[model samples]
Target: MKMEDYTVEFCPWCCEEVVIHAVGITACPSCGKPLAPCSVCWDAHGGCREPCPYGCAGAEADEQKPVTTPPITQEEIDFVMANY
Candidate 1:
């Protein structure tokens, strides 16, 4: 069966077999294990954030925060101009 086909579940955190709904992907109702989408050494979005549809917290796995574009300020522009 495919991953999605896993209607039944084993919570990685609790590591016990669990009852899953038609499309559940988060906590195990029994043990409350936070399940997440597993990728190649990372979550698919390239951040520590849970990729699981249910957004289950996983193995302290993601250490990196998401990258963001810093806001540009007029002072920053002036500093760049002065330096350049």
Candidate 2:
């Protein structure tokens, strides 16, 4: 089969098996859950191209996406307990 015929199938979020067929290039299905376009690899995802990092579950893009939530801090927990 041709390369384009192949699909980079993968659910951007749930890690489900989603097909990135020739036509599926634009973006994944925007179902109930929020969707965001791949940040690092924009439209290039077309043609079932390179694999995505974190895969994004196809949510909407944003100027500021933490991408990485802050690690839990002991001081913060302590304060919460103190107040309680």
Best by TM-score: 1
**Reference-based lDDT, residue 76, model 1:** 41
Question: Lowest-scoring 10 consecutive residues by lDDT in candidate 1?
Answer: 62-71
Off by over 4 Å in 2: 1-3, 29-84
TM-score of model 2 relative to the true fold?
0.25
Kindly list the per-residue Cα lDDT of model 2 for residues 1-84, writing each as its tens digit.
233332334444566533232322333332222223333245553432244443433335521233232222445334433443
**What are the Cα lDDT values of the candidates?**
0.40, 0.35
lDDT of 1 by residue, 34-75 (tens): 443333224566765444444435446522222122332445
Point out where model 1 deviates above 4 Å: 1-6, 36-84
TM-scores of the candidates in the order shown: 0.32, 0.25
CA shift of 75, model 1, Å: 63
